[model samples]
Target chain A: MTETPVKVLVVDDAATVRLYHTSLLSEAGFAVEEAANGLEAVEAALTTAFDLFVVDVNMPKMNGYTCVETLRSETVGTPAPVLMISTEDRPGDAERAYAAGANLYMVKPVSAERLVRVARMLTAGRGIPA
Target chain B: MGLVRRNTPPPEETAAPPSADTLLSQLDDPDPELRREAALGLDGSAEAVAPLLDRVAGETEAAVRDAMLTTLAAHDTAQVAEGLAVHLASDDAGLRTAVAETLATMPNSVPALLPRLIDDDDHDVRVMTAMVLADLPHPEAMTWLAVMIREDPHPNVVTAAIDALLPSIGPEHHELLRGAVERFPDDPFLRFTVEAAVK
Candidate 1:
């Protein structure tokens, strides 16, 4: 049987941001989900198993850090691989996200091409784990 | 540490037409930093670990995988979760302890994880495990703490054992610290901590 595409969850407080991230990954053939904020993202992570999740640090309900914290703490769920997106461009922000368990922190204004290249590289050759 | 400046973009990329999954496909670009950055990017996200692991497993680069693993280890992804289980079983004492310590952070994993440190083959693991458990206020764990104080071979273990005991020690455990002081008389850290405990 042919395999299904890998799924990704895009999370941010901003609808525009979610759509943009979803576009980058979806065109690359990844199935995509969206959450308006970190809390909804955590809820989505709890119920569905996505291959990757991109989160923003600043949000009303829960921030990116809190979202990662929740995923790590809740054991029964499939933990989404966390990529932190933030505009907090301070030096320590990336370090803080890493410390809080973000896999990678990307500063804002990244090009769409770079996003596609990065997603393609990460999901390559990783078949669904049984 | 203001190394970079940025703008607030839309939280998600909803504005763009959906793109293909070729985000990191150009990993072969000439820049080694690209490979390194690709490794970083591939970490933690489900879409990221498999390729990074392949890069680590196949590519000759020694350093690339560490960054990837660090990122993978941060999230409790399915791959990372399995890796955590294997790491707990690792024979290397320090690595086992470190893995246990990391796994201990998640409350959902407390049952499977807490016992590893208690019965850990390494003294450091045992001591650290005891320290972690002291907060739970388990009496049985305290008994193991006392036993380790009375028995571990390392001088630092003796002191660490004493330090672990300090959190919840009672009158019955006084003899254990006293005995450790005698066993590790040359260890000033132990001697001081024990002397303080018994007095």
Candidate 2:
């Protein structure tokens, strides 16, 4: 029996970044979905079941922190691991991400290898194709 | 009985509109609605630029901020552009977006300040400015974007410039895109973006 691919929702306001992350993950055999902002990410989370969320910190309508909080809130209550990637590398940025229920926080320009490895580690045993 | 119309020149215009000073004070009112009204009332008052910018820095209410920004945008002066440009560094994403949106509308005023903003030490600010340039209707936007694509050191900021250039890409820009690819040879995303645009 062929198992379903692990699903990931990549949220970013920049279309190029979204396409880049989507392409990387798709090439790695994950079913990747894209959202332009936090509001859209929340909307997608409501109807779709994603195993992971790759969120960007700075976005219009709703930011990554608020989006992650909402996903963990009763409104959505998604238990999927959230990996927040942002250009903001201030002292408390990572702490803030964790406080908002993110499983991990990474800086921008995260290497392609690291991204795939971390994503695979986070979604381990979630039916990702071998 | 037959109706008779009596008009006495609308009560002789009893109350003159509030002065700019009066409206300026009202910006501090406890009621956000009053603050919004005050902002709107300050339109075309050049001296109000400083105070409106001060209010924007701390304004929590979105409606009031929008009102202030709208009032500022009407000025079309370098000071207004400079005042708005400072907020691009704000940590609040909503405020940053709002400021960018407001700045984009001031094509005449914002161009003078673009160089300094694009050269900001913070890469995020550069990225935001690049995005703003994409929406600015000024004729020089393409030149600014091409310079960024060829010279900006950061991949994210350069990527934003590349995205801005995509709408108007031409054969003339192919070499610039190739230069960007060469500048960041290891960045797959940048290379992919250049490939997509050149294709």
Candidate 3:
């Protein structure tokens, strides 16, 4: 049986940022879907069982914090590792992300190599059936 | 909360085209998807504008808000502009940016919304407001941005103002930019912007 590529959701409001992240992850053999904001991300999550979520913190409708909270809640509990990224480097932002169930919190303009390395490291053994 | 997807068939998609009343009621549906669908279903009904604007103001879901914004943008009315203006001060940067993008697309909407947005207590919102203005043909965005450079207390907002003002700067605005450079001597980026503006 062919091994299925790990699936990831790339959520951000900026079109350019979504494209950048999608390209990087697609190149690394991950199946990726894009959501323009947290609401879209949540809607997509309900229909799909993704292995990882690369979420942006400050989004309209629902923010990354609330999105993760919902995902961890009974609403769409997948327990998939969440990697929250944001332009905000404020002191409490990361802690809030962790408290909301994110596995990692990273600042924006994250280097491409590091992003891929981190994605790979985080999803190493978690394989979902296609 | 239990994640419940309301299994009821959407009223808007029922056999007959949904009446305005049915659509309006769906706006209050428990599912965000149903609310978003209701917002989209109200398109092209002039009678739907006021009710839609009211729903937009109370909308909590971003997807639903986006649907309502799309409907409002389709109709250029004072009420629509007023409805859009309130989101500029939203804590969610994405929502604020979405409202800005919507304003940029609707020319008439920009003027009415700018003053409040430029003066918003959140400097970040003001910064975003300036960024939206930068993309428009109206000089008012630049004009207010120049004012922001001089009067706005936050360096971030000022820097955003300078960035928006730079491409359109003229010799007539030299003194204003120079004053800004002097106002924040410690802001290297602002100094660089002013130097570029003067040049």
Local accuracy of candidate 2 as per-residue lDDT tens digits, B52-120? 999897998878988999999988788889988999988765678778878888998899998898889
Q: Pick the candidate with the highest DockQ.
A: 2
Higher-scoring candidate on TM-score, 1 or 2: 2
Scanning candidate 1 chain A in windows of ten residues, the lowest lDDT window is A121-130
Q: lDDT tens digits, residues B52-137, model 1?
A: 54443343333443454455555644455445545443333224334444444433434445445556665544544543444433
Alpha-carbon runs more than 4 Å astray in model 1 = A75-79, A127-130, B1-199
Candidates 1 and 3 compared by TM-score, better number: 3
* Candidate 3 lDDT score at position B84: 74
**lDDT, model 1, position B55:** 46
Clash number for each model: 33, 0, 1
Output the chain A TM-score of model 1.
0.89
Query: In what order do the candidates fall by DockQ, top score first?
Result: 2, 3, 1
lDDT of 3 by residue, A1-130 (tens): 5577899999976554576678778988899999988889888999999889999875555668888888888989888899998655556767888988999999755767888899988898865322
- Fnat values, one per model, are 0.00, 0.30, 0.07
lDDT of 1 by residue, A1-130 (tens): 6677788888865444666678667776788899977779877877788777787765544657767777777452454567777544555767878777767788654567776666666566644321
Worst lDDT run of 10 residues, candidate 3 chain A, spans: A12-21
Report the CAPRI category for model 2.
acceptable
Error of 3 at A23 (Å): 23
**Number of the candidate with higher DockQ, 2 or 3:** 2
lDDT on C-alpha atoms for all candidate structures: 0.59, 0.89, 0.77
